[model samples]
Target: MSMFIRVKRKKTTYFLHCDPSETVLEIKQKLQALSENHVDDQRLILIANKLVLEDHKTLADQKVENDAIVAMTLKIRETGDWEEVVIDKPGEHPKPDTDAS
Candidate 1:
């Protein structure tokens, strides 16, 4: 069966259509296509358990299900480190005051 995952990074979210048997590395390759980031430079973390997805494991092996939310972190070329997760939500902004002075 086919499923989809919501891969989020900063303010962007990529809805990737995939299957349970697909390995995490495969997912990274697909993300690379859209993100232009190499598979080695990408890291995926399952939001539900905060578990880092393994490259050699299948999605089902990691218990990743349909419509799951995964955070994407990119490697910093300067420091050779993975950046922190930061998913911006649209509802996070404060609303303007409705009362007119």
Candidate 2:
């Protein structure tokens, strides 16, 4: 059975019918095809209890269930530099931190 997953990107929320057997990179590839971003630049941040997901892991291994929402941030290369974009939800203001750990 296909799992129903929701992906939030900036102001847009996309609902995807995904197979649990598929890897995280595969999902990122689909996102690349649907959006203006490239697959290599995509970063699928696993939001299940604030855990970071690896690209090679499958959705089932991540415990992603139906109707789960996945938050993604993109690292796009523009004009000879890489820009990291964090798509915050509405009414949430976050302070910018320059500390890279």
Candidate 3:
């Protein structure tokens, strides 16, 4: 039988069905696409009854049944603001007004 999994991130949430053998990464990737967001180097965690799901751990490994409720929280990271670069006009230099000389 197929299992239904729920993922919550920020103010968004998603649901998907998977086989019992599906990994947490699979759910993470699917939720990322659904929310149109990119995952940072730090990964999301899946918890069921206060248990931390491992990377190589699958739902089947945790004995997750169908219609499981999963909790997702973001990993805090130190990030800086984006810098903008202003480019000068291509090969255009100011010349002295010698025409009137």
Question: Which one is best on lDDT?
Answer: 1
Each candidate's TM vs. the true structure?
A: 0.90, 0.73, 0.61
Question: 1 or 2: which has the higher lDDT?
Answer: 1
Tens-place lDDT per residue, model 3, 1-101, is: 68787665444456787887877777667766776544443244444564556657888887677876566655444553321222234455677678975
Stretch of 10 with least lDDT, candidate 1: 92-101
Please give, for residues 1-101, the per-residue lDDT of candidate 1 as tens digits.
99999999999999999999999999999999999999999999999999999999999999999999999999999999999999999989789989898
Compared to the true structure, candidate 1 yields what TM-score? 0.90
Q: Point to the candidate with the largest TM-score.
A: 1
lDDT of each: 0.98, 0.76, 0.60
Measured on C-alpha atoms, candidate 2 has an lDDT of: 0.76
Task: Score residue 3 of candidate 1 by CA lDDT.
Answer: 100
Q: Which ten-residue region of model 3 has the weakest summed lDDT?
A: 80-89
What TM-score would you give candidate 3 relative to the actual structure?
0.61
Worst 10 residues of 2 by lDDT: 76-85
Q: Which stretches of candidate 1 lie over 4 Å from their true place?
A: 94-101
In candidate 2, what are the lDDT values of residues 9-101, reduced to their tens digit? 678777888999989888888888788677777666656665556789998998888888787776644654334445668778777888999
| CA-RMSD of model 3 | 15.6
Model 3 residue runs over 4 Å out of place are 39-48, 79-101
